[model samples]
Target chain A: MGLKEFCFKKSLWVFHLSAGSCNNCDIEILDLLTPRYDIERFGMKLVGSIRHADVLLVTGIVTNKTKSRVLEIYSQASKPVLVIAIGACPCTGGIFTSSYNFAGPLDKVIPVDAYIPGCPPKPEAMLAGVVKLLKSKNRE
Target chain B: MGKKTIVPIGPYHPLLEEPEFFKLYCDGEKVVDMEWETGYNHRGIEKICESKTFEQVFYVVERICGICSTSHPFAYANAVESIPGVEIPVRAKLIRSIVGELERVHSHLLWVGLAGHFLGYNTVFMWAWKYREPILDMFEIITGNRNSYAMFTIGGVRRDISEENADKLLKVLMDAKKKISLLTGAVMDDPVIHARLKGVAVLTAKDIHDFGAIGPTARASGVDIDIRRDDPYAAYEMVDWKVITAKEGDIFAKAEVRLMEMFESISIIKQCLELLKKENKGDIKVKVKEIPPGIGIGRAEAPRGEVFHFVKSDGSNSPVRHKIRAPSYNCITTFRRSCIGGTISDAAIATAAVDPCYCCTERMTQVYDIKTGKKMMNAAELIKLSQKKTEEIRAKGDKND
Candidate 1:
């Protein structure tokens, strides 16, 4: 199969990483797949394993303990993968940024393609970020 | 017989991100045994509360979890208020009930969305959340901030819901009632959802009581203990609403209980709004002096379940120790035992149904040898790819310069 056709056809399978978020972002990520947004209709499915995913959507500030897992998940994704940091927490460390426990923003560990900003970014904005990332072909 | 394989489900799993480790002994499709490790998100919130004054500590305690932020402060405030033996203004009491129940409305709607997604019912997830936005807008109008509404203060709340906001709230509540009616019937009647969730992850009533399970978990298992009723606070004493409970102790039952509870929340909101209209104007929050030095225990029914906040004040600027016990903490205790015999696919549903909050749950260190662990490629290759990206970014920056 031609490379373009293959990438387009497979569509990006998202693996949501909770770098130490407030579960609000994680819940919104789940909301995108629900009937309203119906992300699956756009050919994007939330995958369980990073091995099978094409994009990594991370939420929350990267803490000392969770940094390794974030790096590990990023490593597991096959090459030409995109990482979308969702929520204000991951983008700028949000409220928890002041805590001594937090390591820093998610970009400190791996490359981030886009930032979806909100304490917990609304489900629509999250979906919009994914669509923008996919069309740009910037990850590869 | 084939050897049973042990699969470690987290501490850093995508399906379940709450910093919990679930070791499952599985023989192909069937899980034989399970073990779960927790305490990953432990931030010593209680320890931090030790030095703050009662007033400053109130705000700090609320930061424990956004989903249950209101409940924590309300409970802590109540505990301290009770110590002073202060009689909160009648209006303040009713407003507290209204705000607490309103928080429940948004929280339950949020949980409904999560429960739907966990079972792969994306349609229900979206429908529930779409309806939830209006309720949050109502929250925003009343308390300014939607998620962390600092409405509750010691002895009373910070502000009152003006008559105009009350009218808007009544209209919004009416809309929410219609949407919730449609959703409850849809969730209860959906075949795919029922097949996946019914009778899955059963926790018996006896088991619930023994494990110190609170809120919806205990109620789902038929344990009739809602702090709103047992120990009335705010205007819950004046309002009339029934505590919703179910006997199933499974995911399906919990969803059903939450859906039905939304109706009760609507009932309380209507009552409170009516009271606001009748009362017109009164003191929203009473002025208070410094809280005496002592330890206080505040308990309330958060949307998820019972939220307990233990605060210690040294008569200082911040709390000396503020321990927060989120409902899922009690629920997670049951995971290791309940997950036995379930499949890897079922693990997500089982875990997510408890509404486990990973951001609040602490994490433990996970060390894996790079070369031997499950890897699509080696560390060197990934590092090289990262270095290449860095070089490209530098080149782009130089070009711009």
Candidate 2:
């Protein structure tokens, strides 16, 4: 196996990017770390810096102010980064799609490796999305 | 301006859930002053609400914050209900209080967890969040979702508290209360928590009034102003719970008020459930055939503070203009009082003490030396600085022991 694959096949560190979310998904991501779900068992953890990440979990519908920043961060990530869009807002601008500043459905702005769908996807759904993406399994 | 380093806290950060910016000007270890700004998460929600019908506005308002999902819609519903010749069913009113109080219990626990995490007390964070899960589970059981419970509608609630589920809710609440009290007792008795939080970032009543602050931020200062008790909306007037307040406006006092209020919320929900059981069979909504032209103002006490919504209708299906004043609009300014004259280490926790819910605190904030204009610190490093200080203090205490 390649060095990159060897390094990330077992452990995944994610950097969270909120283009412009309502914070439901953001808190849910934190919930994934809390004891109830304990996603740490899966060897997936949220890191503060994008440079240390193998996966980029993006939340929220992209507002105009955040769109450029989202693009910048996505570009800065190392190649072989998996971008998973969390929540309906980031997936298709959700309810705020009609709003003037709403510039999202994340894939429109940047390539997405996975999409976890929900107003705010449950922590389980988010975990499943990540696992699926790692295997290059499903697309929805 | 002689020689101050800017400890920038945002634009984006994993540590800070909200995506906003705070430029803390520091003279040595002390924060001399600071400037805060937000707008990164502004989706023009109020502007968008104008296009949707009055009936559809609740779903839109529900997205304001995942933590306080019911607050905005609750306020908006009251605004719509306030339109002349509108009256909701009695059962609906009780349901509103049940949901509101449940929200308080969950939010306070969430804050407690985050506060503990910031203070480097990982165990406390873990314990608090573990207790918080049952509350979310109850929400999921009752409303079919955990975060944003879309129970509120213009005329009344969309769902009814069935006789069977009411008993289930009460059972879940008791389990939550037991766990929460255990957490609260642990938090209250902890000496390290007392040292770190007591008298840290004291915002006096005068400072509170000057900043127009509300909710726990104000109540912690002994400012007895709760929209629930004062305005008497929904089933608040019918309930027997008293507002929890403290004389000192420090972080500890804020923590105390929030912890104490969780019990009050539990009590309120219990009372509402009992009342619902007694007078259980009633309409959950009053069908408003049409909305007449006029302006209506409504306020609901969110977990953060008073959520105010003003709706202007012009004899149409959709509102002409809908104005919302989130509690953060008032409470966020209070940071001017809290952050100034404090150590840079105390800065993050101090700002978080008010629970500003700043939407713009969303991205990776680039910190600079300000003078050299070169990147000096990332968000994690700054948060680490705060956690490190707490650890040092704890280590010294251990040495003294």
Worst 10 residues of 2 chain B by lDDT: B359-368
**Per-residue lDDT tens digits of candidate 2, residues A19-127?**
7888899989999889999988888888988888988988888888788888889888887788899999888888888987887579999998788999888998988
Candidate 2 segments whose C-alpha is farther than 4 A from its true place: A137-140, B360-401
lDDT of 1 by residue, B96-143 (tens): 888888888888888887677667776776788889878777877998
Interface RMSD of each: 3.0, 1.6
Per residue, candidate 2 scores C-alpha lDDT tens digits across B149-210 of 88987788999889888888899999988888889899999999999999999999999989
| Candidate of highest lDDT | 2
Tell me candidate 2's fraction of native contacts, as a decimal between 0 and 1: 0.79
What candidate 1 keeps of the native contacts, as a fraction, is 0.22
Sum up the clashes in candidate 2: 11
